[model samples]
Every structure is written in C-alpha cells, then in structure tokens.
Target: MNQAVPAPTVSPLRPTDTRSTAPTRMPWLSLAILAAMGFILVAAETMPAGLLPVIAADLQTSEGVVGQFISVWALGTVVVTIPALALTRGFRRKPLILTAILGLIVANSVTAMSGDVVTALVSRFFAGAFTGVVWGMLAAYGRRISPPARGGLALSIVSIGAPAGFALGTPLGATLGTAFDWRWAFIGLTLLAIIVFALIAFVVSDAPGQAASARLPLRRVFLLPGVAIVLAVILVWMLAHNTIYTYIAPYLRATGTGIGPDLLLLVYGLASIGGIGITAVLIDRVPRGLLHGSVALFVIAGTVLLLAHSSAPAVIAAAAVWGLTFGGASAQLQSALTLAGREHSDVANSFLPVAFNLAIFAAGILGAVLLQSADGLVLPIVMIALGAVAFTLTIVGRRTAFLPRR
Candidate 1:
C-alpha cells in the first residue's frame, strides 16, 4: 500500500533562472566538494584515534580516556542527527551544509587549542553534531543536484570521501602528529574544513527545501517500506564490521602473523577504493547483483579470516576482500533508502547516521564482552553470524528495497 510520491522537484541552483529548474548537466565539481566535506568530517572524527598517545600526554590524561573521544563523538551524532533534520527540513540545503562545515572548523580549532581533556571532548562532541547534519544531507543532495538517471553515480562519487577518509585521513593525522605535534592533527582538519567551505560556497549548486505541505513526519519516513529494512541492514552489517575492526589489533596479535594493524588497514583501504570504483561503474546497471555479490564475497572473506588466522598472506588477502566489500556500502545503502523514500529521502537519510553510530557503540560493547569472556577468534565467528543475517535481509529486500532501475 505505498502512496504515490512525486519525483523531487529540482529547483534552480541560482536565483536568476525562473523556468523549470532541473539541472541539464552533471555537477561534478559540486559533487567533488560534497565528497571533500565527507572526507574532512570522517577524518576529523577519526584522527584522534591515530594521535592517542600524544593527545593524552599533552592533555595530561590517560590513553584510555582519549580513546573515548571516538565514542563520545558517535554518541553526539546519534543524539542530534534525527532531531536536527526534523527541525530543519525546510532550510536551504547549501546553507545547512556550509554551517555544518563551519561547525567542524570551529570544533577542530577548539580541539587544537584546548589544554585539558574535558574541553577537547566537548569540541569533539560538537564536531559529531555537525557531522550529523552533513552526512544526513550528502546523499540526498547528490541525488537532487544530478540528473535523475545519474543519481547512483553521483552517490558513489560523493561517498568516495568516506573510505578515502578512513584510508588516508587517519594516516594523515598520524603523519601530522608524528611530524609536528598532535594539535597539528586537529589544525590540519580545520584547514581542510576551511578549504571545503570555500569550495562549497562558491561552486556547489544550491537546492531548495521541501515545502511545508510536502514534508513528511519523521515517524512516517521511518515506516516507509524499504527504509526500515535498509536501516536494519546498516546496523547489523556495521555492527559486524566494527566488532572485528575495533579489536583488529588484538585479533591480529593473537594470530601470530607478524602483520601489523597499520599495514592491514592500508591494504583494506586501498581495496575499498577499488570497491568504490567497481560500484561507480556497475551500481546504476546492477545494484542488486552487485550488492549480492559483494555481500557474498564478504561472507567468504570472513570465512577465510576464520580459517587462516595464522597465515599472514591469507589474512592480508582477506583484508583486501573485506575492504572491497565495504568500500561502496555507503553509496549502495543510501541509494536504496532514496529509492524507497523518494520525495521523503532527506528524513529517511537521517536515519543512516543514527543506525551507523548505534552499531559502532554496540560493536564496542559486543567486542569488549567477547574479548573479556571468550577467545579472539570469536570476533570473526560473530562477524560471520551477523554477515549471514545481512545477506538474508538483502535477499528479502530485493523486490521492495533494492529494486533495479527501470
């Protein structure tokens, strides 16, 4: 019993154009700017992880306390994203985006100058609150500004920033911390945010917000046919990923493989980039097929990790496979949600960060419990179990949620 929803009304990016305002050309430059925004947000959120020792020493806190920076930020996003989006549904998209980026610049700058852990943690929480706005809008913005047919490609292009952030951003923070001071890492993120701010303001096309009559209630968006299913998949799949990923160093240490976590993450990150490329090429054509294949490959990769814990080469190979499985996940899931929610995509999209952050928080708890009570090998076993659930959900949603383009 799905109600008919109008195709998104593409308002003119500029104020001068008065006729039908849909863009005839692809906004690649704008898409890149949005991608850069994603890049800085993720890098800023994760950079602290790479600078734990230096940050803790400078703030005169323990490394264990500094580690909570990531968790606190995730909690902030979970707390604010949905409510923020619900309240601001009618604001112009570009201003909301710019304001969020500015918030990041301020948050990072504050973190760079803070002398104590309390001040720094407050800044990180605000940074995550801003992230809630930016991430919630990125996919919907990509779709609204692109040709309807090219939405998937635009999403893939924009989403490249996330995996790229994980691959390059964290390492960049580490490099800056090592070369200069840990404060330089936050300063570096602030600099990147400033550059992204200018690019978005001048180059990115602006889109109008939904009219009051057209806006859907947040609860209505939540109950939309495919929205809940997609959110469920994000939760389970990411729970599985973070469970293993958060404890990757411990797990690798147990494996007797001499391979370090940094090297393993690098391999995975590069493979994730490759995965994004593959999705860009094929997502528009075969989303269901591509998703199915990647998830299946992911399950196989988990199996490999389970069986070859002692072989460095096998573990490395499995990391590559896992990276590929994850690289395009943001694009794929966001696209599915958009298709299902149609005109209500913005509210629906906001659920993504909520589900994602909750998964990270849950994974931390789940992984900690297992590590304390059982063997490290149990982490992968949990991954395999959750991945199987994700695979089944995708199968169930094939007709309703992951439907191929006509």
Candidate 2:
C-alpha cells in the first residue's frame, strides 16, 4: 500500500537507552495526563447530549431545536480544524496544549451561562471550534509525547478520551442536571478544565514537531490511498452511530420508560469504558480486527434499538453494544489514520479530528432531520448502509492497509 510502516514497540526518536536520566515510566504519566485532557475536551462537547431535554425545556424550544448544540459545535470544529492546526504548526507543544485547554474552560463557561437559543448556538459554535483544534493537537501530540515505537499504543491511549468522555460526560451531565441544573454540568467541566490545565503545565514535556521546521500543503496531507479510506470510514461510522446516539434520551422518552435517563446513560458510559479498555489492548495487537468488529457493532446496535422499543432490557443491551463498539472503534480508527498517513502522521493527525467532528456535524444534521421526518428510524437504515460501506472499505483497506505483510 506504500504507507508509513507499522509502529515499533520502542520510540522512533532516540533509540532506547537505559542510562538516560529521564525516568522510564515518565512518558506513561505524561501520556495519561494527555489522555485525561482528551477525556475532558470530549466531555465538554458531548455534555450537551446528556442534557438535551433539560436544555430544551429551559430555553422553551423543541428537543430537536435544542439538539442544534451538538450540530453547531461539530460544524464549528469542521470549520476551524485545518486552519488551527496549520496556524499552530511550529509552535511549542505544552503552551499550545495549555492554550487549547484554557479555551475549553472559556467555552464551557460560555455554554453554561447561555439561556437563549441564539446565545447557546453562538457559545456552542465556539466551543466546538476549540474541540476541533484540540483534537487535531491531540493526534500529533500522541505520537510525539511518547517514544515513536509506541506511537500506535500512544494513540490508542489518547483515543480513550472519546468513549471515556462519553462514558463520564453523559452520565455526569445527566446526574448534575438532575440534581442541580444543566448549567451545573458545564460549570463542572470548567472546573475540570482548570485541573487539567494545571496537570498539563506540570506534567507534559516538549516533543519533536511541537515546533516543526516547515509546513506541508493541506491537499498533499491525505494524498495517500488509505488516508482517504480511513476518513471515509470515520465519517460513515460517526454519521451512522450519532444518528441514533444523539437522540437516546428523547428516544427513550418517546417509546417506553422504566429506567431513569441518567441511570441509562451511566450504564452506556460504563460499557463505553469497557470498550475503550478492550480496544486499547487490541489496537496494537489486532487493529483491523478491532475496526471490523466496531463497525459491525454499530449495525447490530442500531438494529437492536429498532426492534427493542418495548423492552428496557432490550434498550440497555443496545446501549451496551453501542458503547463498547464506539469506544474501541474510535481509538482503532485514529491508529489507522496514523499508520495510513505514515510520514505525514502529524498532518493526518490534525485532519483526523476534523473528519470526526465533520462527521458529527453531518450526523447532527442527519439526526435532526430524521428525528423530525422519520421519528428516528434513520438509525437502522443508515447503519446498514454505512456499515456496508465501512465493511467493504475494511476489506479493501485490509488489502492496501498499513499492516506488515503476513
């Protein structure tokens, strides 16, 4: 496939030397904090999902209208990701990262205080832009923060933020909203941002490419064969999944009810955590396998949700399937982008978040339309169609993927 070679176990930078003064375990600690940053940034973005209904009532808007928070945030990300990554090139890593984290604090605070639809849209739009850039930063950061050999593993760890953020954000927002108000959820996110900011200030170290010597054209970034394929799969995956996921609360409210909404999200988040853990371990060992299972899981989850409208157990089961698949899939796909883009990993990394959020933006629009038009049946139909494309891509991608020869 003529892509970047698969990552080795040791770093690609300096060859592993045991006599160095830096603690061997130090990178792990730094990467973990980076993972936490990934967690909170994502949490801030998806927090709107858990509190969707509450925000609607408080603003006197329909749930679909309130759902624009997710849509606009993603759109903002799509708009700013490339430009932000391009502009930030050649800047030092820690300060740029700290700035991105600081932006989150401000964005979450903006969303927290918004009471009108217009205000919410503007606030969420900026918040989403911050998320997109951070995600781009996170991709390149993951590879350089640790040894190059463990780059895939490093990215796997970074990917933990997606599902973990959802696992924590959805339930945390729901619980906070249930106890205090939806505003409290964003307030809590702001507080976490402060903590993460401190952690980044102290823990994360400088890396290579934090201040790159040169820049590449954006079009030349994803010129590789598998790069576009990975982007397509990510777009299809998120579009299919979020089509239903963004509406989980309302879907439950409409069809049947036995479990509390917060509790339901908690269960789903836990499953997402489980999925993240599994994928992290497998990403290095069996990445394509993990990707295939993840896309397939989406199809299964959508089907389950469609048929299980009457059963609480059925819905819970669907949530579990959805979470586990999404968690693993998100990380594995990021790894795929890194591998496929090869020498252009940084460019690939920057663009990956853009693709994800762009897909989210697309899905947000698709979901709102489906919710209004098809009453949310768009999930199953979209899943099957997207899954087929993803699965087909998986097959073609395997033949041309960045894997070493068998």
Candidate 3:
C-alpha cells in the first residue's frame, strides 16, 4: 500500500516576523473575504440570466437578442483577462482588488440604470472585463495567503464562491424581478459588491513580494502542455453545463413538470452549495484521479434528465447531481491548473476564469441556435457530447507525465 505524503505546509506569515509570543494565524477569515468578493462579482454577472425574460419585455426585444448580453459579457472577459493578469503582475493586491471593486460598482450601477438594451449590454461588457481582473487577483491572493499544504482546499473555498453566486444570484434575481423589476436585481448586486469591497479593503493585506517581480512571463506560462489540457477540460465542462443550465427552467416548464421558476432556482442554488461543501471537505483526501472521474457523474445526471422527462422526481434529483458535480469538478480543475502552473499560478489562474467565460459565451450561442431549431433533444445531446470530450480529456490528462503524481 502506497501512503500519500502530504504537501509541505507553510505558516501564513512572513519569515521575518519572529515574535515568539505572536498569536496563531487566522487565514480562514481572509479566505472568506476573498470568497465573498468572488461571490459578489459572479452574482453580478449571472443575475441577468435569471431575469432575461423580464429584461427583454422591458427593453421590447426578443429573449434571444437579450441573451446576447451574456455572450457579450463573456467575450469581454476573455479578451481582457490575460492582458490584465500579465500587466498587473507586480502590482500590490490591495489596489488591484480595490480597482476591480470600483469597476464592478460602476458596471452594476450602469446596468441597473440602463434605459435600453444596447446600454445594458455595454454595461455587462464592462462588468465582465472588471470581473476578469477580480478573478485573477483573488486567486493569486488566495495562493499567497494560504498555508502551502492546504492550497487546494483554500483555493477551492474561494472558487466555491462562484457557484455559490450562481446558486444564490439566479434565485434572488428571479424573485426580485418578479416582485419589482429586473433592474432591482442589479441594484442588489451593486450593494453586495460595495459591501464586499469595503470588507476586503479593510481586512486583506497586499501580497508580500508582489512588487518584486516586474514582468510577467506570459509565454513561459502558456508553454506548458498541461496548461492547455487543463484549460480544454475547463472549457468543455463549462460548455456542457451551461448548455443545459441556461435553459433549465424553460426545459422544466416545457416538460409539463409543475416546478416554478422560484423553486427551480432554489434547487439549483442549494444543490450548488451542497456540492461546494462536499468538495471542500473531500478535495484534500480524495485522489485527484478519482475526483476527476466523479465529474462524469454530471454527464450521467444530464442524460438521466433527458431520458426521464416524464418523472419530476428524477428530474429534480438529476438537477441536484448536475449542480454538485459541476461545482465540485470546477474546484478540482482549478486546483489541477494551479499545480500545473505552480511557477506562474496567477497567470494560470487567470486562464481558468477566461476559459470559463469563453465557454459560457460559446454555449450560449450554440444553445440558442439549438433552441431555435425546436429540437427538444438537441440540448441534452450537446451536453453528452461535451461530457464525452471532458472524459477523453481527463483520460489524456492522466496519461500525461506533466501532471503532479498521486
């Protein structure tokens, strides 16, 4: 029997801080704040998706056209993430994060007040660009502050905020949209952003030695074969998940399942939270290969939903499984990517979010086209195709000598 050797642990403090009487470090609070920032930024981005119909009615445009707003946001994020991460390589974390929060505030405010569809789309674009910066900075910050042995767990905690945002934001936005207007959803997000911004500004410190490195080695970071494989895995998974998620409520309604939008949103949000919670505990203990294998369960869940269209209980169970696997697999992939780019974790982390948003953009376009075709089976088929791609990638990744050994 081969016993697993744990990764070496680092104290979450500077070496020069040699005060023998110093209190034990508390990194978890800082991690929580970083996670909260992620949650708010993601919520701000995804809130619109749940309120798409309301926004379309308000703007007097078709829902299809309104959906383009999400695409625009993802496109903007992909375009900006690499450059932003590279350029800000040596900047202090506090200012980098603060600037992102400011941009988010402005973006949310603009989106909330938009009088027309074009303006709303532009606001979402700016929001995405700012969100990219935040995502990169937060990941770097999490790595810097965490005890080395627990890096995976720490990063997973911060990453969990994104799915948590999805879980909460969609339901919150739908509920608010139904009560007042979709604009209020943006307003609520703006307030959440403000709160997180203030908390982070007060609690989080500038990452040590960040300013010591003057230039980011972008070329070297991208040169790793594992980086590309990890990115491909992330992209395929997101594409698969979003193709079904973007229309989950609609699909539920179409199947004559009496589930309301509010209840569906609740299920998604709670299931995602459950997934993240489970992963937070299991990631450090589970073998990386087994963790990767578990993502296939999401594919299975999506297929089950497609096949059992007449069973409401089965559909709901599948939804929970889908949410759990999607959320868990995301954290696993991020951890794998960070390990693959250990020398340039920030840049590597930047790619994960960029790839994620780009996949969302692609999925939206492809899902929209599929929905227009009126083929009830197309979405699930696309999901299974994506799942197959993910599984193949996982197998190929396992064969690669570049990945960290179990």
In the range 95-173, model 3's lDDT, one tens digit per residue, is 7778888997998799889999889889888988888888777877786766656666677668877877887877888
Candidate 1 to truth, TM: 0.85
**TM per prediction:** 0.85, 0.88, 0.87
- Residue 167 miss distance in model 3 (angstroms): 2.6
Predicted structure 3: lDDT:
0.74
After the best TM-score superposition of candidate 1, give how far the Cα of residue 216 lies from its true spot, in angstroms.
Answer: 1.6
User: Over the stretch 156-238, how does candidate 2's per-residue lDDT look in tens digits?
Assistant: 66777776887888788889987899988888888988987898788787654433434667688788768888888788777
lDDT value, residue 265 of candidate 1: 69
Clash totals, every prediction: 0, 4, 1
* Total colliding residue pairs, candidate 3: 1
Clashing residue pairs in candidate 2, if any? Answer: 10-149, 11-148, 11-149, 12-148
* Global lDDT of model 2: 0.75
| lDDT (Cα, 0-100) at 260 in candidate 1 | 65
Residue 328 in candidate 1, Cα distance off native in Å: 1.3
lDDT of 3 at 42: 70
